[model samples]
Target chain A: DVKVTQSSRYLVKRTGEKVFLECVQDMDHENMFWYRQDPGLGLRLIYFSYDVKMKEKGDIPEGYSVSREKKERFSLILESASTNQTSMYLCASSAGTSGTQETQYFGPGTRLLVL
Target chain B: AQSVSQHNHHVILSEAASLELGCNYSYGGTVNLFWYVQYPGQHLQLLLKYFSGDPLVKGIKGFEAEFIKSKFSFNLRKPSVQWSDTAEYFCAVNALSNYQLIWGAGTKLIIKP
Candidate 1:
């Protein structure tokens, strides 16, 4: 079985504060992704990493950045939290080819609030 | 760019009701389809996926989906839904060219007791 764990289930931060959301996957998957899920807007991709130290910007990469220093860990960074950035953040990992195939396993998600 | 669309935003059904949730994608080339469910306060789980062959795919919890290439649709269905089946369903598509997944807005299913 694959397990994806997040550092926090819930978090609260004041505006301008820096915030970090961490995700660790037990499986040695080669791909990891960060997304923010908003009601009505669905899950918008924030960033993704195909391998350690490599990253790609997704559809909604603004106000967020990601780091994958290790194959098992992916970190999402909010340089300065803002009220609008409050949302349910999710992390997922997948193996196999880079595109068009593979099932992604997801973490429980972190609900972040920027006050 | 690839995109996905889910027909219903919210659906209410009594237990034992048959279920069908519509999903469609827009892309010119071959694509992979997936249906994922998220129970209240729980992480997302795969319901079913269609990559190739046997258009109909069955998944955990008795959920299934059919991929219709001509229609560009992949709809999820269940014979008889239970109260525990209540969850938000998301339909996603992956274009063969890239790793990016185009997602639908999602459909919230509520099964009454």
Candidate 2:
């Protein structure tokens, strides 16, 4: 069984504060993703990393950045948190060799509240 | 723009009632369809997926979905839903040539006991 774990399950931060959310996967998957889930808006991708130090922007990547210094860990960084950035953050990983048909395993998600 | 659409946003059904949720995608290429379920506080998990071969695919916990290429639809169905089946269902599509998966807004299903 694959295990994806997040650093925090819930977080609260003041406006303009810097925030970091971490995710780690034990499956050694090469592809990792960061997404923010909001009601009615669905899951909007923030950024994705295909390999160490390799990052790609998704549909919505504004105000957010990601780091993949190691294969097992992926970190999402908010330059300066705003109330609008409050959302449920999700991290997922999939086998890189597999095509788009590969199934992505997800973490439990971190609910961030920007005050 | 390519995207996935789930018709129902919220659905309430009694236990033992038959269930069906509609999902449609707007992509004109070979695609992989998926239905994912998120229980109350649990992480999202794959309910079913359709890549090729059989259009009718069965997944965990007695859930199933059918892919209709002509309609560009992949609708999920269950014979009888239990209270434990209450969850938020999301429809996602992955175009063969694209790395990102287009996702639907999701349907929140509440099963009454």
Pick the TM-score winner: 2
lDDT of 2 by residue, A19-105 (tens): 999999999999999999999877888999999999999999999999999999999999999999999999999989878888999
Pick by DockQ: which candidate is best? 2
The sequence of per-residue lDDT tens digits that candidate 2 reaches over residues B1-113 is 99898999999999999999999999998999999999999999999899999999999999999999999999999999999999999999999987898899999999999
Q: Which stretches of candidate 1 lie over 4 Å from their true place?
A: A97-99
For residue B18, model 1's alpha carbon misses the true position, in angstroms, by: 0.7
Model 2: colliding residue pairs:
none
Model 1 chain B: lowest-lDDT 10 consecutive positions: B94-103
lDDT of 2: 0.95
Query: Each candidate's iRMS in angstroms?
Result: 1.0, 0.7
Tens digit per residue, CA lDDT, model 1, B25-103: 8897899999989999888988888888899999999999999999999999999999999999999999878888888
